[model samples]
Target: MTDTTDPRHAHREEGFPAQQQDQPGLTDETRPDPDHGESTYRGHGRLQGRRALITGGDSGIGRAVAIAYAREGADVAIVHLPEEQKDADDTLALVRAEGRTALSLAGDVRDEDFATRVVTETRSALGGLDILVLNAAYQHDIDGFESLSTERMRRVFDTNLIGMLFTARAAFPHLEPGASMIVTASVQAYQPSPGLIDYAMTKAAQVAFVKALAEEAGPRGVRVNAVAPGPIWTPLIPATGWDAERLATFGEDTPLGRAGQPSELAGAYVYLASDDASYTSGAVLPVTGGKHL
Candidate 1:
C-alpha cells in the first residue's frame, strides 16, 4: 500500500517523480501516485444511492475514480484484465475502506460475452447501475507504422474501441434515466502519433462514438462523455514500450512541464457521473497538461 499522506506522493506542483536510472526496481511507491487527495476531497454524497461500473478500475486513473466515487457515496464494480488482479485488489480495498461495497471482476474487455457478463454480475452484485465508465485500454509501441502488424492493430482496436462499445451496450439496458456513461479517450485522439497509429486511431474513434451515443441517448436521459488524458505515469509506461529515458522525461515537454496524476483526473469522472453535470453530455474533458487540442 502507498502512503497517501506523504507529500512526495501527493499531487505536488513539481508532479510525480520521474523514473530513476539508479533504481532498477520499481515498487508501488515509485510508481506515480494514483490515489491523491483521499484525505482531503470532501464529498457531499453527490452519487449517494447510485452504483457505478468502471472498466480498468484496477489501476491508473480508474483506481483514482473508484476511490473518489466511493467517497461520493457510490458503490463500484471494477473490471480488469486477468493479469491485473493485484492492482484490482488494491482498488477494491480502497473502495471498501471508503465504506462502499466493491466488486472486482477479471476478464478481457475484448470479448463481448465477457463484457456482458461483467455488466450482469455488477448489476446483480451492486443491486443497480447508474454510471458506467469505459476505461480499459491496450497499446503496443511500434517504431513505425509499417512495422505494425495487422494482428496487432486488430487487437488494439478490439480492446480500445470495440470493447468499449460492447461494455456500453451491455450496460445500456440496466442504466436508467439520469445515468451517465464516461469513456477514457486519449490526447492521441486529437494529436496523431506516428508510432502509435493504431492506438491513436482507436482513441479517435472512441471520441466519435461518445458523441454519437450521447446524441442518441439524450432523449432517454443517459449522458455520454469522454476524458482525453495526456501523458500520465502508470504501470502502462513500463508495460508499454517506453524506455527508461522516455519515462524519465515523461510530460516534461507539455505546457505544464509535468505529467498528470491519476488522482487529478478523478474529479472529472466524479463530476461527469454526478448530477452536477446534468446538462453536460457528449463533451470531451482533456486532462492533457495543457496540450493544444
Candidate 2:
C-alpha cells in the first residue's frame, strides 16, 4: 500500500490568524508558531562533521535551517542581533540537543565589523568552516515608493546585501575545496511587489550575487547557490507591516493555495550543502509553492 497525502492540505492551508510583531520578530510571539522540523526531520549523516555559519538563525527560515543542519551532524554557529538573544538561545539549545557544538553570536549584521568578525568567531569556535548559509535578511512594507524613507531603504540594503558580502568575503579564505555557500534568496526576486519594493530589490540583487560569485567560487571547488522561497509563514511576515486582511490571505495566491513552512525548505539547503550537489553550482533552486523563479 502507498501512503497518500494531499499537498494542498498537508500542513497549513487555512488563512493565517491576524497577528503582528516588531522588527526582528520573536518565535514565541508568532501565533500558531511556525514549524522548524524538530519532530519530523530524520537525518542520515548527510552533513556529518561539517561546520556551518548561518546568519539570522535566531528565528524564521534561518532558525529552521540551523536546526536541520545540526540534526544532519553539523556544528552550527548562528549570528543574530543582540535584541534576538532569546530566540537565539532557543535555537542554540535545539542545536545542542543534537549533541553538536552550537555557538550564538549576538551582533547586528549591518555593522561591517561585526558581520566580518562573526565569520572568524564561527571558524574559531567550530574549528573550521565548510558550509556558509548567508541567510540574514530584513524587510518592511512601504505605503508607496514616495513614502519609502531613505533610512529604511538603507537598512534593507545593508542588512540583506552588504551583510551577505561582508560575511562571504570573510569566509572565502577559510573555505576549503568542497565548501558550500547557500544564500537565502526569495521569490520576490522574480515577482516584485509594490509594498515590498526595497526588500524585493535586495532579494533580486542576492540572486545576481549568487550567480556572479558562483563563477568565481566554482573553480576553487566551492559551490555558491541560493534557495528562493515563496510566501512562507515566518516572523518576517507578520512584522513586515502588513494589514490584517493582507496578513490573513498572505499566501493564498500561490498555486499551492497555501503558504509554505520553514521545515519544507530544509531539504533544499541540505542537498545543496551536501556532496549530493557536487555537480550543482550557480543554481537558484526555487522552494516557492508552485511559483516560478
Among the numbered candidates, top TM-score falls to 2
Instruction: Report the Cα RMSD per candidate.
Output: 4.9, 0.8
Worst 10 residues of 1 by lDDT: 18-27
Query: Which pairs clash in the backbone of model 1?
Result: none
Model 2 RMSD vs true structure: 0.8
How much is the lDDT of residue 3 in candidate 2?
Answer: 94
- Measured on C-alpha atoms, candidate 2 has an lDDT of 0.92
* TM-score for candidate 2: 0.98
Candidate 2, residue 282: lDDT? 94
- Which residue runs of candidate 1 sit more than 4 Å off their true CA positions? 1-40
lDDT of 1: 0.82
Superposed on all Cα atoms, model 1 deviates from the true structure by an RMSD in Å of: 4.9
lDDT of each: 0.82, 0.92
Best by lDDT: 2
Off by over 4 Å in 2: none
